[model samples]
Target: MPRGPPAIEKPQLEAKKGKKEEPKKQVKKHVKKQVQPEIKPEAAHGESNKDRRKQVQKQTDELFASLDKEFPVNQMGPEPKQGPKTPATPTLMSSSSRPMIRNPPPFNAVVAGTAASNTAPTACRSAPSPPFPQPAPIAPAPAPAAAGQRDDEKRWDEQRWDDKRWDDQRWDDKRWDDKRWDDKRWDNRRWNDQTWKRSRVQDWRWKEEFERKQKEMDEVLAKALAREDAAAKMAQQERLAAEAHACMSQQAAMREEVAAQRAQQERLAAEAHACVSKQAAVQAARCLAWTQQCATVSREHEQQQQQQSDAPKMQQQSKSAPKSAGNWKHKNKPQPKNCHTNPGQNMRDGRRFKEIMQKNESLKAACKEAEGRAAEAEAKNKELQERVAKTAELMKKECKSGKDTLEKLMKQHEECKKELKERIQKLEARKKDLKERISALEAQNAKMKEALTNEQKEAEEQKAVKEKVHRNEDEQKKAAKRQKTEGPAKK
Candidate 1:
């Protein structure tokens, strides 16, 4: 690879040295320019000086070319050298070090490369090697023979291997068949063995004891189950009974309600009938009273007509009597002379007196008859007034009774409405209470079911454990019996 430029310490030092020298030279030139005087030279001297200036410029160019060759052209300038200790130029750094222009590695490429490198060692450490060399199998020790014990031990091992093989085969078969395995037959086989019989005899005794205990437990369970069943039945029966009772009560209530309604209806009907009858009676009484009034008015009118007719007749009689009086007056007027000597004059005076007395008696009789008719009419008018007054009094009494009954009916209707509202509220409250009780009972039932499930699981687990222990004891006993039988034969 091409190495980066060798660290140019000398170039940097020269550039720094030039920067210091340039400032000193500038100071010296400024002093010289200040000290030197400006002078006007002749044309010939000016031309000679121009040639001299050209010669000096040529020499200066040669010197500059030599310096340019020795150091770079850029090094000739009085620019400051960059160093670690030096403060960076703000403009140069800002322009050259723009963040946006820099090229960076792609994120995925960098990550993938890093991950490849990082995982290399881990792969080497974790990778499996080719199959390892097998370890030497350990040789089993030769078992010391205890006469016939050797055969028994061999038989026991062979039987154990057979049992293990059978168990493995059975497990595999069950898996292959997709069938459920039952321990019941295994448990029964263990239970039927000779050692298991002795152990079971002991266990049977223990089991008899346990059975006694279990019997007690079963009795207790049965009793508890019976109690629960009885309780459930009783509760069901109670509920049924209660429902029946409620139905009966409802029936009774309905009957009572019907009866009450019928009674109320009858009462209303009776009241309606009574009101109708009262109205009819009142109407009848009013009609009768009106008829009576009309009859009384007709009778009074008839009596007035009769009185008018009699008055007209009396007036005619009075007029006739007055005419006779006028005739008597005219005849008496022409007989005035020799009144004491005439017998005829005395007879005329006697006749005139007799007629005047008769006329006065007739007038008195007519006056008495008119007085009697007026008295009869006055009595009839008074009777009609009494009848009218009695009818008005009866009507007022009937109106007062109707108003009182209407007020009473309004009050009863309001009371009935209030009672019905109260009953509805009570029924709603009872319904809420019953709903709460039902919710509580449901929650209790859920808890009981959970407890029953847990208890059943525990009982099954205990049964499995007991069966395993019984099998182990039977196997041990069979091994012992086999050893004993083989020992005598070996001897």
Candidate 2:
């Protein structure tokens, strides 16, 4: 009769030649997780593998968004570029005995209804995935060899065991076909730290450039303001100088006019004094002749005394005349021309002095008029000086106000800068705290998943052991029954 399938044996791992083409185990446990991220969100409740994958993918997208936008990643196919460094891509193969599902199963069987769990996941059809390793099927324990068994029977049993081993080996090979890096779409791309460092350095350079531009703009604005202030000061100085020069020119013109008027008045006064002195001298001469004619008797009495005095004077003169030279002329010099020997000459001199005094009086009147004009000019000059002083004070006040405003603006700028710095620091601290909390939560979740997976493995192992024990006992009872029946028949 045709024999049945060989007795099943425990699944055993097979040894392979090389490691490159050999596939590895799968599931999140086998793959490495992303390293510490700069920014991380807190973990939330998730039911299935798809939810977890989506979460991790979102975080990865956020972290590399800048890079990805700047340099788009190639996501054309599942196969990587062909190079010596590139690893082989996984291929699906058909198999017998065990049915392979083209679609993925429901992630959470407990949450899904029984009917839903039996159905495949909808995502598998849209997206292709590599095969995954399944748990090894439970096998019955091997039957012990009979003591009286024939040589042919031993050979057949050995042949059956070999066939069973081969079948299990085939299953193992198909299950772990493409386990390593199969979960990631971009696994072929380079993940060297140098690439990441380059991107980070680029970002830093951009920030520095922005800061430099801002500083340059501030400097430009400051220079423009300074230039405007300097221009205003220069204009003010020019205007003040022009006003001062005009005032000085006006004062000089007024002084020259007063001096010219005074000179003209002095000239007229001198001419008038000369006319009065000549008229007085003529009147004195006329008066002197009249007086001499009236005083003849006095003149005769004076002549007798004069002759007595002249007798001694004439004798002295005659002696002095004989020794007279330039030295004798100097010793007996006649009375100086200014000496008032005649009464008429003295009278004319007094009259001339009086006329000169009267002319000085008239000149004093003209001087008074000039002084009045000077006072008026001085008053105008004082007004102009007051105006200049007022303008200067106004400029000073404006300058002080400008300085105060500048100082206030500076204070406000400093305050705002400090506030912004404080706010940025607080936000950074908050971000750090959130990141730390998220990392802790992720670690905790990983530990819990690991424990659950380990517990499942232990439970499955214990169940397999128990099943093997039960199968062995059943086979033992069957062998004993067969020996009892066959033993009687052989006799």
Highest TM-score against the true fold, candidate: 2
Candidate 2 residue 318 C-alpha distance from true site, Å: 34
Question: In model 1, which runs have C-alpha deviations exceeding 4 angstroms?
Answer: 1-371, 479-491
After aligning candidate 1 to the native by TM-score, how far in Å is the CA of 368 from where it should be? 4.9
lDDT tens per residue, model 1, 321-359: 656655675445453232233446546645654664565
Output the number of the lDDT-best candidate.
2
The TM-score measured for candidate 2 stands at: 0.27
What candidate 2 gets wrong by more than 4 Å, as runs, is: 1-347, 358-366, 369-377, 403-407, 421-425, 459-463, 466-491
Q: List the residue pairs that clash in candidate 2.
A: none
Clashes of each: 2, 0
Q: Candidate 2 vs. truth: CA RMSD?
A: 27.8
As a whole number from 0 to 100, the lDDT of residue 320 in candidate 2 is 72
Give residue 36's lDDT in candidate 2 (0 to 100): 24
Give one digit per residue, the lDDT tens place, for model 2 in 154-214: 5334433333332222322322122112313223222333355346446655655675577
Instruction: Give the TM-scores of the predictions, in the order they appear.
Output: 0.26, 0.27
